[model samples]
Each structure stands twice: as structure tokens, then as C-alpha cells.
Target chain A: MTNVDTILKDMIIIPKGIFFRGSNASPDEQPIKQILLSAFAIDKTPITNKQFRAFVEQGGYDDPTFWQPKGWAYIRENEIKYPNYWYDNHFNQDDHPVTGVSWWEAMAYAKFAGKTLPTEAQWEYACKGTDDRKYPWGNKEPTLAYANFAYDCDPTELVRSSTSVYDHPKYKSFFGCLDMAGNLAEWCLDNASTNYKWDRDGKDPIYITKDEDYHMVRGGCGLHNEDFLRCTARDYYPVSVRDNLIGFRCVVNNVKEEEL
Target chain B: MDILDLPQVEESRRMVCVCNWSIRRTWKGVRLATIIEKAGVSNTNNYFLKQISVGTKEKGVYESTIPLEDALSRNALLVHSVDGAPLPMEQGYPLRLFDFGLYGYKNVKGLSILEVTDIYELGEWERRAGYDKDGIIRPKKYWMVDLKGWGFAEKPGEMTDF
Candidate 1:
């Protein structure tokens, strides 16, 4: 195990263990269960246009190795370049969280960055933190200090948000990860699994199966209502489906020997 | 209403058979009784539920209602659990109303405001697209099916890249 702090400057360590997952209010969110996770390093925020540009400049679209087998076939078949929101082959701003990228695009970018999309369990573990606060800022209702949500900004204008990821201090998780609750609902590594198989006896359980078509996306986005702003709210779409409301953060299985 | 503050009640049922999106999904959740009780409407025993509206900030509204007695039934649910787990977004994470008697449109997703008013009105699709407001479903209920000509089967065109 390598020391996360020594190996990476921007990522934060989400300590491993049992974390509170799911919500009690919704039926699909029932069976509020706990699961164990191994320690890992996760990005402090969703990827920005500036970060994604490196992948694009590295010829991410043309490269085959960074992509999954089917992802390569799909993107190549469509001749896709840039995200869905990009116009004239350019993003609105360099610092804005990159939106309109499919799960495949986001996953490929994670590979290019030497990281992986956080698993659904890992993503939930990061948000739930030590105390399992409803929002990353705790049970408090969101204000401008919390998230870019509730249709507060124009959806069109969000791709060019002046709110750099670091702006929401209140939205930071207990581990010092910002935008874990809101920004753009991030893509996770797991395929959509409503069956939320709780592994109380197992360690670092990732709940996904091969037959799944939809992939999990957590955290809420700019145009969502306050109901979606909570940490427990889970979202998903077809891996190939691209939308302006979703972006993603990356995680790595980096554990420090000293901490271990 | 504060979701946490609401009187939490866990109820499971086997009746949900979503024809379009989900097929034979077992949904468990906090009871509509608990939700209405949380909304301080426990006194609505005799009065029928006229309109129960659930909506997102971006999308206008997805509204439907049930009779008071049916809304209070054990089978009907204000579901959050899909197959023994926390709901996912496209399936409505924090909450999704599961009215087994009515069609899927009444089982709204992305609940921001759940206004329970005595307003007997058709939801967005039921009125605009000519779906039967009183969508009753049974395997042999063929007569009711024709009333729902274009029914809630049509997906929204405005949903561009959500």
C-alpha cells in the first residue's frame, strides 16, 4: 500500500469501513444497509473542462486502450468528439465541471488520469462520511453556500458556471472532498443495481452485475430540486446516454501502509 | 416536508407491475399513510385524495391522485425501495409514489413538492396527451385499455439530454 498523500496531491483519502448507505424515505432506497470498503483516494470534485481537455488533447477519442471494448466500438461508430454540450468543438469554460459526457467518456477519462470511477459503494461511503450527513454539509437545507441546484441558474449557463468546484466549502465531505453531494451527479463505476445487495459479512462489496444496461450516477446537479440535493439520492442512465446534467469524479485504490 | 422528520414507516408489497419501464419490480417503502400523516392529513379518512403532485424544478409537474381509502391501502405505497435497496435516480431515488391501481404516470419520480389538494385534475400526460385520467389496469380489462389510446406510453420530447 502506498501513502495516498505522498503519491497524489489533489485526491483525498476516504477511510475504509462500514458506512451508512441508502435512504429510509423512498422504497427503492429502502433496506438501509451498511457495507465495508477498503481505503481509497478520490478526487475532491467532479472533473472540470480544464481536466478533460488533457484527455482530448491526448487524442482520447482516437485511442483504443483507454476505453472499454464496447465503448471503443460505440464512440468510433458515432464519430463522436467533445461532450454533448460542446459547441464548435469547444467547452463553454475551462474551469466549469465537464458535463454532457457519457459514462463511457467519463470512464475513459478516468483511465487516462490513472484512476477509476468510484464504485457505488465507494461513492456512497465518501458522501456518508463518519456521521452519514444527509447532505455533505450535514442535514442543513441548501443555500447558495451549498450547491448549484433548484434551478437557481440557467441550465444552459451551467456549462459555463463561474462557480469553480472549490467554491462550495459547505458542500465538502468530512474527508475534505468538495462537491460530493452536488455539482453534476457523478458517474460511478458500477452498473445500475436496484437489488442493492448488502454484504455485511463481506469486505468492499461492489453491487453490479453483467446483465445491467444502466450505470449508477450519484450526487445531484444544478437544475435539480432540493429533494435531489441529498447525499443518499442515487441516479442512473444508459452508459452511452449523454446529458448536460451529469459529470464525474475519479477514485484510485491507493492505501497507505502506515494507515493500514 | 422534511423527509427525515416524517414519521418513517416501512411497508413492502408485491403488486407493482410497470408495463413500460420496470416489469414486476417489488417495491418497498415508507407508507403513504406515514407521508400523509407526516403532512398532518390523518383526518382525511372520508375525503378522497383529489390530486397528489410530484415534480422537479426543471420539469413542470407530474400529478395524480387516488381515492382516500385506496391511498391508505396496504398495497398502495409511497415507495423508496426497489428490490430491497435504495432507489436510483432514473427510478426516483429519495421517493417515488407507487399507486398500483393506477397506471405508471401516477407513480411519479423526482419528488420535490408533494401537494395533496382536493383537486381532481389529470396529470401532465393524462390531460395533454389524452390518457385516461382514471387509468385502471387488469390483464383482462380490455375495455379500459382503449380509453388510454396514446396513454402515458409516450415519452416526453422536451427531455433533451437529461
Candidate 2:
């Protein structure tokens, strides 16, 4: 009946706990920290072209109710009519994961749909769970089937297959999320920081939200024959920037069992 | 002017792209500030150049800026050489940038326009995707491959052109 009721399907619930936040293999990832997050509901897959199309068709771009103050200004300045790839007249189908939307666009989509982008902390907790299991499916390495990477095709494509969008048991995270490792880098609601160690604090930890350099993008994509597919490899881009490799999923504060 | 003709410094570091992947490449080139200086721009101090912008031919991923403080460091360069050879074709050849503070995306490739402007712009990668303008790595390690070894390639042998 409402946006919350319809859009919340296939949303996975991440429980409250102290999950691993960063890795020790590199400088930025160094000083592995523990984050305590309350329960939340995250979309099983990154927002799809078909889903986002509904938002645009519903006047999402024109509606001030769906946008924040700065986001509205950004959309106005860029005159962003729709997803960048949409105008290219490519991947017009409904199945492809939407790419080329900036962080503001992603946030607006979330707000329009009554959801929010998960922070990088919540993203890691959902993907890898409490321990260091290595990936969403398990400790195993990724192949073509597990998540989409190392491919030479165009940027936007289906999330492997129609069934894999929210049903593929293998691609699901411990909290039942799909495409956590590859497919597309999902934007998190955190700023990119070299000193992430100091930013770690408990209770719905969202870091570098204001006066920040870059917003955070999690997960990996088919672009770059990279080790970026690892669950811990966080990436970033400026707020105004857009890319073919970028897309995002949405999350919500977990309601009580009776509320659902 | 040819980048090779400018004063060159050997820049070596375990470079990591935005994807949280690492590559150890030794590059030689002129400091980005030096390149700006050779272009006849006066007052190349970091403060004045903080608003400096860079434009690349790559689309969607548009303009970028260097806090001239970072640009002045011999660490950042408009590199033409990597590992005693011309910059590889797979890599951004001819002239590519190195941002000591930002990720490899911040180290923009296929550079086209270099100017001092007030417009706050993002790289084509930064613009198209949500990459950090500051080039700091995010805390999550959900990387595609592991350059530091997760039974993954521990060296440049793991790098690819995709």
C-alpha cells in the first residue's frame, strides 16, 4: 500500500553486535576495529534499473520531498534527468543493476523508497558477518558464479541472472544479501578517510558525513581486473562524481518482529 | 613540453587503487607542481593551488583538484615512466598522475586539461562512481582481489587491465 510496504521485500536483517570493521593488511585498513551496530534492514541486492525506473517515473527527480537540501541543489546544478546510462540508450532493460548515479542520487532513491544507504560498518557486518570468514558465500575464493568480476563486457548488466538478484542462495550474505562482493560497488553513507581508526565509535556509527572529502563505496564490480572483490576492500569517489562501475543498495532501521 | 624533460624524481610506493587493491610500481616523472610551474603559473603555493583543478579526457569521470600541498610533494607526479620503461599501454601511458593522498583513481590517467580554476570537480571515476576526492581508503576490505595475499596475488603479477 505504501512505499515502505512494497520496497521492503527481500530486505535482510543484520543483528546488533560488535562486527569486524577494518582489515590489517594495508595502512588505511590497518588497526582492525570493532563496531557495535543495532539491527537494520538492508536490501538483498543493489537497486535495479527496473526499481529505479519506478522512482523516476514517479517524479523522483522533480519531487523535493525525496531529496535533501544539498542533493536537490546537486541535481539542479547537474540537471541530471535520469541515470547517466539511461540516456545513452543502452541497457534499457529492467534487469541491469543501475549504475552512474552519484551518492546523492542513491540517497534520494533511498529516501523516495523510505530507506537509507547502509554505512560501511553495517555493510561489512552484513557481508562478512561477525568473524573473518573472508566473503559472503564463505571462505572460498570468487568465481564467475559467486559474484560478477573480471568481465570485459559493458558496465551495467543483470546481477548475473534473474534468479540471482535476490534468490541465489550462494550469493547471499550471512544475513541473506546478494552481490556483496562483486556486481557493483554499493555506496555506503560514510566519508572516505585515511584516519578511519579515530572515526570508529559505537551506536549507529556514520563517519565523515559532513566536511568530508569522499563518500564511501563498498563491494566490487566487473571493472578493473582487481582484487577489489574482496569483502574488505572499501573504495571511494567524490560526491559529485559518477561512474559506470558505481551503484548502491538501500537499508532501513530494523523494526520489531511484530511490526513486519 | 615533454614530461621527460622536466626535473624527474623516482617515486616508489605500494600504490592502491580505490578498489583497495595494491600495486608496487616505481615511477619517474616531474612533480605536478613543477609541471604547473613550467606552464608559467606563478604563486604555486599549496594554499593558492588548493582550488586548482585537473581535467582528463575520460568522460563521466570529470575534473579533479589537487590541494597544491599534496602536489608540491615530490611524491605526486605527472609520471611518464614506470619500472625503467615507458608507461604501459594498459596503464595510462604518455602522462598519468600520482596522488600521494588519494587512491589510484585520484591518480588520474589519460590526462588532458590542467588548469587552476575554482570549480570543484571530480575525476571521471570519482564523478561517475562515488570515489573519494581526498583519495583516502574506506575502512571495509570487500576488495575484488587481494594484493597483500589472501591466497591471492601478492605481487604485481596479480594486476590486470580489466
The superposed Cα distance between candidate 2 and the true structure at residue A251, in angstroms, equals 2.2
Off by over 4 Å in 1: A1-7, A88-91, A151-162, A198-202, A258-260, B1-162
lDDT of 1 by residue, A125-184 (tens): 787676978887788887766877643222455233425677786557767788766567
How well is each residue in A1-260 modelled by candidate 2, as lDDT tens digits?
Answer: 66656666768766677876777655555567777888778888888888999899999999988888888888897688798777543434566678778888898999888888888888888888875767777777766767667542223454332222543455667777887776578888988765365664656677765723468788776663335666677666677656666788998886556434
Chain B TM-score against the true chain B, each candidate: 0.64, 0.69
lDDT: which candidate is best? 2
CA lDDT, every prediction? 0.64, 0.66
In terms of TM-score, how similar is model 2 to the real structure?
0.71
| Model 1 agreement with the true structure over B1-162: per-residue lDDT tens digits | 555455455643323222212234556666677777766886665555544335567766666655566656634566676777888887777777766666566566765555655655656544433334545432210111212211121122111111
Candidate 1 lDDT score at position A254: 56
Point out the worst 10-residue segment of candidate 2 chain B by lDDT. B153-162
- Candidate 1 chain A lDDT trough over 10 residues, lowest sum: A151-160
- Top candidate when judged by DockQ against the true structure: 2
